[model samples]
Target: MHHRATTSRRTLLTVTAAAAAAAATGATASAHAGASGDRRLHGLISRMSLEEKVGQLFVMRVYGHSATAPDQADADANLKEIGVRTAAELIARYHVGGIIYFSWAHNTREPHQIADLSNGIQRAGLDRPTPVPLLISIDQEHGIVARIGEPATLMPGAMALGAAGSRSDARRAARIAGSELAAMGIRQNYAPVADVNVNPANPVIGVRSFGADPQAVAGLVAAQVRGYQAAGVAATAKHFPGHGDTETDSHYGLPRIGHTRAQWEALDAPPFRAAVAAGIDSIMTAHIVVPALDAAEDPATLSRPILTGILRERLGYDGVVVTDSLGMEGVRTKYGDDRVPVLALKAGCDQLLNPPDLALAWNAVLRAVRSGEISEARLDESILRILRLKAKLGLFRDPYVSHEGVDRAVGTRSHLAAADRIAERTTTLLLNDGGLLPLDRRERPNLLVVGADPASPSGTTGPPTATLATALTELGFTVAALSTGTAPSAARIDEAVAASAGKDAIVVGTYNVSATSTQRTLVSRLAATGVPVVTVAIRNPYDVARLGGQRATLATYSWTDVELRAAARVIAGRARPEGRLPVPVQRADDPTRVLYPVGYGLTY
Candidate 1:
């Protein structure tokens, strides 16, 4: 994420001083290591033909048969062969500099699936003796976006970290996330999205961003970057410039940045700037278009003026520049005229990720170099950065990971325990009327839980009902779980209403954020009946805002196993809701603004 600075003079001075010190230290290391590691890296770059150097900058996917395609049965055999043969041959034949793993094929694989996958791909990269190791990257952003297989430590998304409002909390989350990926032999993470969540309606970046406040988001981004890099995983701050304001998802088509270039400079660029200053190792280009920045191009991914002119020149970002997945419609739909890899590289991207067509990408880059379209110098420029990144990652020394460290890294008991701490800290109480919470399990032993269904599925899990029932049961509350899908199914609502009618206190877990009509109506009905509706926002906090008159809401941010237990602790009066809303919660009529600003939360 190359962010143009909008900073105080004092901060600028501090940054300049830090940069100077880092340069001196880095020069010393490079001078000492140049003979061995640095010399080999330089030698390989010198010996590489233009084709090979260009290949080093291009990272493509191993495509499988389309899941939506019709001839599935026949395609299955071809897909497996495609996975092994395409992967194996890429190393032997193309010697592609890097490879990206798509999570589709290995959905059912075991916990160490990534370990095996990374090993295979790295073996392919090392088939030939390159002085430096090849780069491998994955999209292992936590929450709904995790790409690693089973026993994945699915923590709450960035929004949850925002909810915690603690730098230490975010740092710990990143450390665990980094450890998990590194344990799997994966070294790069396309994560810690620095985009400030300014637009609630943004489909692609809704919960992915930290929050709306630039300062808070910046702090969290910095913390996460340090944690991830400290753990030896290269953390990437993504969607450069910003992707937080658009309503459309760039995955489907080009999303234009309506903000003027200056407006973007002021609002969306702060966190990214903080990230770069924090030494985030890589920046992923967004698929969105900014006409102010690139009037001639629809998407920035294909625009050199934006990528090279602005991101490189104006911002002075020297890190590896990776493009968002090239398989997205944003690039494929518009730039179908030319091969994507060539356009991306010409646009100053150091890596072409998940290239839709590998042979096409390879030949296009090769063809560009042969035809003098892209200079050998430009190719070298990118490879230099790539090699530098590999060296910085310690990959140049030895890309191989120890086979002995498997038991302690991923999905271990300790990692799960850490996940629980993150989950516990992320719970927030958005609303509490007259201290109507902390359902004393000893006092209100016969507790009833209403509104636990797919309609209320937790954002942490991205499924139907939250685990409130299990959490309550664990707390020894005589609990009952019921779903109120769009409208409360008559039977379900009646049962909940009857059960809670005279209970000492009722804890209603309403999936208030974007709830289905039935779920919304059920919540309304329950609220009208005068039961203590401890409405749990298992998803977005805006869900509580949507329940305009329903002021008795609690936001757990997500329904991860960790969050569920934490929410129960809050209900049982064991833990306090020390969190605040990371984003503003607006009233229905005032969609443009928020009724309760970020950082508004109640105490027990």
Candidate 2:
């Protein structure tokens, strides 16, 4: 059952030579170097213990700004979860193959801090007995889910890029983000969300997905994959088999997709196929269940029929397959914590990401291997994929990155300018009634900016209202701001209405007005004030359909500062709104009635 015995020498040489060629020239390898590289990989695999091989399949998260010297809160969280005080200690204990960074976990504070943390983590892994390098990774999707925030270059999210309808822009954004991540010693990015948002009510992937059109989403996903890999970072096409049509968030519950095999092929399969064609380094499995693919109704993360039959055999994707975070309720609901990792591996996932209990999960897998529940060859197959990816990334040669290059590579003025340009292009002017916008700075000298500043997935609100106010102020207009909160109280709405008095114009930022009555009420009351009202849909463009009033409206698709500033520019006539709706917005009361069709936009 040894890998060397099972894998033909010819196949080994081919793989090793390809990896070497990729590292040396980023091209196909010459046959001369194949034997040495193959020998090295085979020798390493033969020498690896069962424990060491099992450890290679896990990607764990540790709470800390510094891997070696964790702060008190970080230390406590790490100790409680993994029985360790620092990332180094956790890695030493578990021999984890990768580490995922999170801002809430304090793993990414800033550019320099992230570089230091990544270097420290790498040192720990290299110091291990087997001397394997860790794959440092982050969400870094840029707009909403960015773990490494500004002064890291924040690009527009997938939907915004879709709105702008430029594949070149998508590629450039991914390359810029990937280069910055690579400069900080991070090798993998879980980004370019491949899910096509077909269902408008989908709570988790609203603005995260590229769009509802399968072909369009596929094109953008492919572009991002090439872009990230071009910059020496692995790009992950995520939530495989698609999580775009479900109402429930996989982080909370397992939603079932009712797509028949034919429907799924037409709607959800294109982006994944495009990603594979683009040579993506990995594909992350979703926790949602699709009965059409598997009769047992197992989540895609634990279904061999879906992962192996559909993704592996059907799609011909040979890269590593990573599962979505196992800590999520979706995966944990069916099985015990110990069994989830084993099930996922059996289902053909090569990497188990963010298992809530690492020790328990690791031990379970080790026991499964020893008990012959999982064959040695099966385990080795996954190990080979993981190790090959590490080698392809040049981690075997050198895993560490320079601290001096961090500042130069991240958030340069040129990168920031690119972000602004892209963000400006994504500002869709959905409504510009009777020349209400391009507000004359002299006529509308005083402006009031008020409404919901919804917090992003990272729990940082751009305080979008304040950001918009600041942007308007910079355009020679006196602006006052009030944050009515995502779900504004009655008192908050009244205060906003009272404050709108005597203002030359009112700009309201709305976040999902269909869901929040208070936000709709806030907009309605503000419109009653008779000041020319301009509504900006900061998160999703669907708010315009629910606002119940004819006014100047813009959809930025996100509440980030870059997006807010772009909205301001369009209002001041500094920049023309060029973005169209990427996805159709249906009327609030009627799903059949399309209020705004895809590619619909109004420009001055």
Candidate 3:
């Protein structure tokens, strides 16, 4: 969709304020910058060459100067030549439209490092005669997935919040996440994934989605949109139509879904509609194929029927539509190098995101324009929308947020407190035997904790661990910590269980990752002992479902410090279990079915 307004609110207000100031000298919106500001912004974007215009549509990856950057100096030089150096050079030479930060190249643990990198990028834009700040974005969807390393704020993933069964809780979580991103000067957040997580076997998007119930997911998606927008950050609802049904990861290969247009409209489009109604600034297309929607074999990124007929026409969403990384295997395998920019433009996408090769993509777009493959009108449309978004973010006229902004807002107690609050509300208990939980204070049953160190040495866990030993200790449970690395060995789980023998109750904590195997054998073995076993799925409840219902379960959906405390509170009866099942729990034997349907949760 093209932008309807080129005149920035800031510029218009500044001009008006300036005129008023000349008459009386008191500051007003018109006097802030005014008509002159609008002209400057417009003129600068208009004066760019076709090459620059093509460049403006290309968004690519830029690794920060942190530990993760490639170490070889020559390779670094090549990256710079490709416009990966300073933000100023990127705009001056390539005129690239935006950037997606991969990871910090060195010591990325400190929040200050991220702030510094963002500041430098913003400064580079200011160096231009007419500054148009880059559309800097990050993948900070909270929970198991986050790009920012330690010493950064991490919240539980969407699944946990969805389980909370409160829209306000989801909004609070988003607000905290957005505030953290905005404090660092980032304007775009590619998050609040609207995918309905119906398939338990889904390799991805389990914890990232709000939940499987259409109405529940829609409500939470709206809250997340409201939270990010309220804090001045652009929120994008992504993988349009849906990516939750597929068993394959688009990064690895293309996944095909048999859903017809009607099926998709009924099952997969509710959250997106809710998100758009809540005013999401952008929508990203998924790479999976729905033959019912588009049979041309093109993914949503290049499918006119999917991107235009469905998204734009049926949904009435006029916001900018961004493509999922063009570099992903889904598009690359079918279209090759030249078709990326060309097909996405034809599909109505306003931005070509995360192209594998920027220079190649630039030429591809330029060639398409010269050969009449893509009209000049199409180019103008995308740039106009990009410019409008920049103005809306107050980036076109003035791109600076003072160091005070960083100091006053980032990591503030208010935001941290909000995270903790959401964490407490989102934890859900999936099973209980003989009212074993909310243990009676008089009994003083011996307690045991059998998971890895859930704390980050700061006495807090993040978006990953839902319950920590220290948090359990605060609940008056005698806690002992056990370490579970990326994947635990069978002996490790057995040893931990053996140590807990003869205890009043057995609590087993396990984390789930897509590629890692779930310990069904270990869980079954423990349940066989019949010693009142309680399993805490500190990652995805789906992890426990793998055990075939042999053990009782609690679904935290994360193991973060805050979530850990929330889970412990639920266990000790300090808090009521309000969260419902966000996604269906499926058993391995019945791989094609669900063991626990959505909305199932136990309460005292």
Highest lDDT: which candidate?
2
Question: Best by TM-score, which number?
Answer: 2
lDDT of 3 at 308: 91
**Error at 10, model 1, angstroms:** 49
TM-score of each: 0.86, 0.95, 0.86
lDDT of 1 by residue, 240-355 (tens): 87888998898887888888878878878888888888888899999888888888965778889988888788888888999888878887777662467788888889988866
In Å, residue 526's CA in model 1 sits off its true spot by 2.5
Poorest 10 consecutive residues of model 1 by lDDT? 1-10
Tens digits of lDDT, candidate 3, 231-260: 778898988979988888898888888777
Taking the candidates one at a time, how many backbone clashes does each contain? 9, 0, 34
Candidate 3 regions off by >4 Å? 1-44, 66-88, 104-109, 149-152, 439-446, 451-467, 484-490, 512-518, 528-531, 548-551, 591-594
Which should have the higher lDDT, number 1 or number 3?
A: 3
lDDT of 2: 0.87
Backbone clashes in model 1, listed as residue pairs = 1-283, 453-465, 454-464, 454-465, 486-517, 486-518, 486-519, 487-518, 513-543
Count backbone clashes in candidate 2: 0
